[model samples]
Target: MSAYDVARHFADSWGLVFLFGVFLFAVGRALRPSARDEYEHARTVVLRDEEPGK
Candidate 1:
């Protein structure tokens, strides 16, 4: 087999597994309880008031 064939096989198999693992980790982190405050702050940061003049 050639380099192209080897690369294609890895991409078609292990690449998918790596991407799925990353997706699961991201989803888990987002849903975890400790992240609730961070998410809430992000959701309302735009509505918060700030002092004028630097």
Candidate 2:
């Protein structure tokens, strides 16, 4: 095989791997629950009841 053909093959193989990685990352992010959800669910507690002006 010519040098050009060899280089092209390598590039194509690596490119497919890179694309696969990106696709997996996108899918994982879509399926995962975010931290914002947890914070929103946490119960709020007031440590100090003092007046705001004081």
Candidate 3:
């Protein structure tokens, strides 16, 4: 009926499932073997791109 009601419904029902699905997906993506190099590159690329100061 209202924004609060809609938000409450999502939070009580589908929101938990959606968050868990996202968590599982993130874990699966991180643990998948092919993602290793990509994540590693992600970790280092930021350092490589940064300069001496912020």
Candidate 4:
């Protein structure tokens, strides 16, 4: 089969479903931005070494 045939075959199979699901998931996330805030939290501590108690 040629490149065109392979492309067309993929478009008709799982490709379309995968694209549709990704699009819906993106929209759903946009509609509920709050759901992602927990992921935005960061917990980190930075310490610097210094000469014995000045």
Q: lDDT: which candidate is best? A: 1
Model 3 error, position 22 (Å): 0.3
List candidate 4 segments past 4 Å from native: 33-54
Residue-by-residue lDDT tens digits, candidate 3, 5-24: 99999899998899999999
Q: What is the C-alpha lDDT profile of model 4 across 1-54, one tens digit per residue?
A: 999999999889989899999999988886687855544442221244556665
Number of backbone-clashing residue pairs for each candidate, in the order shown: 0, 0, 0, 0
* TM-score head-to-head 1 vs 4, winner: 1
- What local lDDT score does residue 38 receive in model 2, on the 0 to 100 scale? 50
Instruction: Give the residue spans of candidate 3 off by over 4 A.
Output: 39-54
**Quick one: RMSD of model 4?**
7.8
Model 4 pairs in collision: none
Writing each residue's lDDT as its tens digit, candidate 1 over 1-54 gives 999999999999899999999999999999999999999999998897887663
Local accuracy of candidate 2 as per-residue lDDT tens digits, 1-54: 999999999989898998999999988866677855654545342455668877
Please give the RMSD of candidate 3 to the true structure: 4.4
**How close is every model to the real structure, measured as TM-score?**
0.84, 0.45, 0.60, 0.46
Q: Locate the minimum summed-lDDT window of 10 residues in model 3.
A: 45-54
Which candidate leads the pack in TM-score? Answer: 1
